[model samples]
Target: MQIIVVSRHLKSARTITIMPRHVLGALAVFFVLVFLSSAFFSFISLHFRLPIVENILLSVQQQETRQTRDYITNNLNLMATRLGELQGRLLQLDTLGDRVSDLAGIKPKAADVAEKPGQGGPFLPAPLSATELQQEIERLATAVDRQADDLAFMEFKLLEKRVEERLMPTTLPVKNAVFGSGFGYRNDPFAGLRSRHDGLDFAAPTGTPVVAAADGVVLTASYHQEFGNMIDVDHGDGLVSRYAHLSAMDVVESQIVRRGDKIGAVGTTGRSTGPHLHFEVRMLGVPQNPATFLKRGEDFARLQRR
Candidate 1:
């Protein structure tokens, strides 16, 4: 290369010398240094076989794959556990379903219609498919609903039973202080010993108020041959009670009466007994143990204690 120099201030001229060889030598050294550095760096990079950017990308990809696998594994395990727990709860619900059905008087098959189970093994089989699981869940929900309804019905029944029990007599028909005759076959006080007595007798002072043994309606209230005056009260549920040997009647026929209501006065008008009341309990016109109905209250109390 050749170069020319010029200066604007020319008061004194100065000459500068230039050498092509020195310039070429310097350029050669520069080329050699660049080649050596490139080779060294190339050797180091190829020997290790990865650049900083590539290594960073590779590490990031590895972490992502590992995290993805872990996430998938954990989620699958959690889903399996949840499905297992749901299956167990569903089993319990099925058992509860049967119990509730029984309580509600719902037969497995009624009116010639029966339920058909899905295609599956026994209830204790392996985990079900998604469709089968969905069906099971639906069945479980239905079972829960049925159980709830059954529980409500049972509560209502219990309340009804309580009301009925409360309305029952469960007390001694005649006063405890005075009872003329006990239950069982006995000679009629009015008739001879050959006659059989249907019910017990209550001996009391004349005009003593005779109360109803239980809540009922007066069925019959008129005179009779063997018994001078009698009142037949028909309680609900096929229960009928009789009050005989009354001096005067206070309630009329077909009149409603409550338990322990004054229905008549005890007297010896029928056969040949002193002032007394003859009481009898009958079910559908059949004679029953009067003492049983009279002790219901006490029996209930004992049961509650138990």
Candidate 2:
């Protein structure tokens, strides 16, 4: 584009040439000037705290503050709900600990007293602040840890009790057998003289199944001149059990056996008057009353049935 300037003072007309690039450069410079002016005015208004500017700034700050407050309140509410759930779970663990303590025959700790019933008087509501809510959550967490420890101890005690019961000679040797002679002094059937009978007798038919009274390793499975086809089991802790006068032996020496495992069959072998099983319990080589252990076994079985 071209533009002619008319001037009477000039000897000739002056001609100016305009291009698209010049128009574009002018537009860019105009935009820069406008932006600088606007920034300068904004700085002055803020520094002087103009009424309109101050009101607008205050409104924006208030909105941000409200959003932050709402966020915090929601978080606190969530924490409080979680704290209540943890308390309920702790109560359940306490009840389970009590039941397990009974089964394990362990006395409850002094701190494990029963919880008091709920109390009520007024319905006044007081909201918890952030600090109070945090403290409560921490306290509840500590209580949960304590309850977990108590439960763990109770579980260990229960397991120990079960192990002891398994090792003791408490199961009946011959099932459905009639009780014959008792332990202690009695008349010898063959000699007809008073003699100390070291074991209890169970009368059953020949070939009736005879089982182990406890878990143990077989120490001897051989014939004794007096007991005849006898089996001795070592039940650890210096306790041993003997099952004598068997028609057949099913286990061998050094074999492991669990309670109620079949070890032999009933038979009246050497020095016996009839088909019967001679059961004896010995601790450290001294004879013990087998009846006591058998009675305990019966009680344990009854509890299991329940």
Candidate 3:
């Protein structure tokens, strides 16, 4: 590049030649200075509220902040509602547990464990704070956990005791059957003399099903001289039930059986005049009145239903 310089001081003219590289360098420097100056002015204008674009950006940022806060509040409220529902259910279970314990005649000593599992206070027409709700949720959760464990344990113990009680010879061996002969002394049909009858007799038709009185193990199931097609079930704690004069025996020796299990069929297979079932309950080989045990069992069942 070349530039012509005119100097009128001495009435002379001079010509200067510039290299392409130097000219390009000078142009580059000028462009860089212009860019820096433009950037500085832009920043100053935005910082001093000199542009409408800046105001719009600030408003968008504020709106986003409010929306975030609202979102957080909504989420907290939802969580609180779910927690309240759980707490309500827990309360019902607690009440049911207490009721069952009273019915079973068992009381828990650790009722006031950790915290009381109940709700009470003044009713206010206002929303709860997030912090307060969170704390309440924690407290309720703790109480429910403790009570649940306690109730589970209590239920197990009661269930075990109930099962033990049921596994006794306390129910009728024949279902809905009437007694044909009473216990104690009776005139023997074969001997024609007063003899002691050790058991009650139910006059049922041949093949009338006879069930077990309670849960027990079949100790003996065989025929005898006086009792035909007999079955003896050994209940726990030295209690036993005998069903005699059956046409057929369904259970074998040593087999475990539950209450109401079909153990035999009714028939007069022994030295009797008619088809009947002889039922006897004994404790440690000592005979007991069958009516006493049956009555007690019936009463207990009625109480449970209520």
lDDT of 1 by residue, 95-148 (tens): 775676566555654732466667865677575655665566567667556656
Q: Where's the lowest-lDDT run of ten residues in candidate 3?
A: 297-306
TM-score of each: 0.51, 0.77, 0.58
Model 3 off-target regions past 4 Å?
Answer: 1-57, 98-127, 150-166, 175-209, 215-217, 224-228, 234-239, 245-248, 254-262, 265-278, 282-289, 297-306
| Candidate 1, position 61, lDDT | 100
lDDT measured at residue 21 in model 1 versus the true structure, 0 to 100: 84
Candidate 3 or 1, higher lDDT: 3
Query: What are the per-residue Cα lDDT tens digits for candidate 3 across 1-306?
Result: 688888778577788899988989999999999999999978887878775868877899999999999998898978788687869978887897788778777765673445757998998888668787788788888878887887787778889878877886666677656666677888888888999888888776888898898899999999988898889998888988999999999999999999888988999887778888898989899988787777766632332110
User: In model 3, which residue pairs have backbone atoms overlapping below 3 Å?
Assistant: none
Count of steric clashes across candidates, in order: 1, 0, 0
Best by TM-score: 2
Q: Which parts of model 1 are misplaced by more than 4 Å?
A: 1-140, 163-169, 299-306
Compared with the true structure, all predictions reach lDDT values of: 0.72, 0.90, 0.82
Off by over 4 Å in 2: 1-42, 114-121, 299-306
Write the residue-wise lDDT of candidate 2 on 44-147 in tens digits: 99999899999999999999999999999899989989889988988898788778878878888565576878998989999888889889889989988988
